[model samples]
Target: MSFRPVIISLVVLALAGLALAFAPTGTTARPDQGDARPFQLRDTEGNLVTDTSLRGQVVLLYFGYTFCPDVCPTELGYVARVLRAMGDDVERTTPLFVTVDPERDTPELLKGYAPLFHPRIRALTGTPEELAAVFKTFGVTARKVPGAGSHYLMDHSSSITVLDRQGRVAATIGSTDTIARSVTTLRDILGKP
Candidate 1:
């Protein structure tokens, strides 16, 4: 009946309003240093990796997708070099590639892409809701923007979050951070001089 349709429309509008109210305002929300937000998402092999799984390891988590045009690859390349320079200390480090565009970057896609950039890096992804929650917890913002043809690209925060063994965010690597700075940051995390 007309009344039923009206009620459904009202309910939908209310839900939309609630969502907007709760959504992060702009990109001002930055992750505070040493805040370790627990998260659970599927890895490249489809295994669920949680905060507990990353315990006792230094984590270099970069949110990106394989299809990213520039920034993702550039940052990842620097990370690879830094990890390689870590020598044996790399054993205690975990580099993660978490996709902002999970719709196209499946576990299988990551399996093939992550290793190509760095042997030490692994990829992760999850349901849209799961991704949204994780992003919110980390103060990351990612939204799909229209691209060429039918394809689309994600506009997301390009910072790399460095988590120490305690899973606390130790450093935030900006998009323009030099490779030397990245290496220095990693060394600092590993207690190297």
Candidate 2:
């Protein structure tokens, strides 16, 4: 049998391993935590949403485009479940969906897409430059992969960056994490239980 498939599988595994290695573990906060930089992007309603404006509220930030076929929808569904499980405690939290493909994911599209996952989930977008800075701040990497003519896909890191009431990087929940685990983490951050 040819080793081409084996080699490809090994390379894919290695890349996934590296991504996990560098990703933040959802655990107890360290003394050096709270390193997330400030960001400003426009919401679906054409209002500017900034880190400062969200102070005193726990933020669950996710980066994905509406055009994403599977991953984005799955992750957002997970977020919606977590929000539902939060019960009344959800009031103190904000879930944000920041699009990586601003060219395709316009305000009108986001306005419809975000509410489908959860009414509380606000979709944000900005200029390429603004998005680049936010990506750098969150250590998120998104690249365009050419597909069929005039079509492209984004290969991006998938993780939910949880910010504390003070707008600090409190924890990170991997896309593969269960809804139960996510609810528990958010509860811990919110000091609920």
Point to the candidate with the largest TM-score: 2
TM-score of each: 0.80, 0.81
Candidate 2 regions exceeding 4 Å error are: 1-32
lDDT score, candidate 2? 0.86
Clash-forming residue pairs, model 1: none
What Cα-based lDDT does every candidate model obtain?
Answer: 0.82, 0.86
Error of 2 at 161 (Å): 0.7
| Per-residue C-alpha lDDT of model 1 across residues 125-165, encoded as one tens digit per residue | 98888788888877788889998999988878888888888
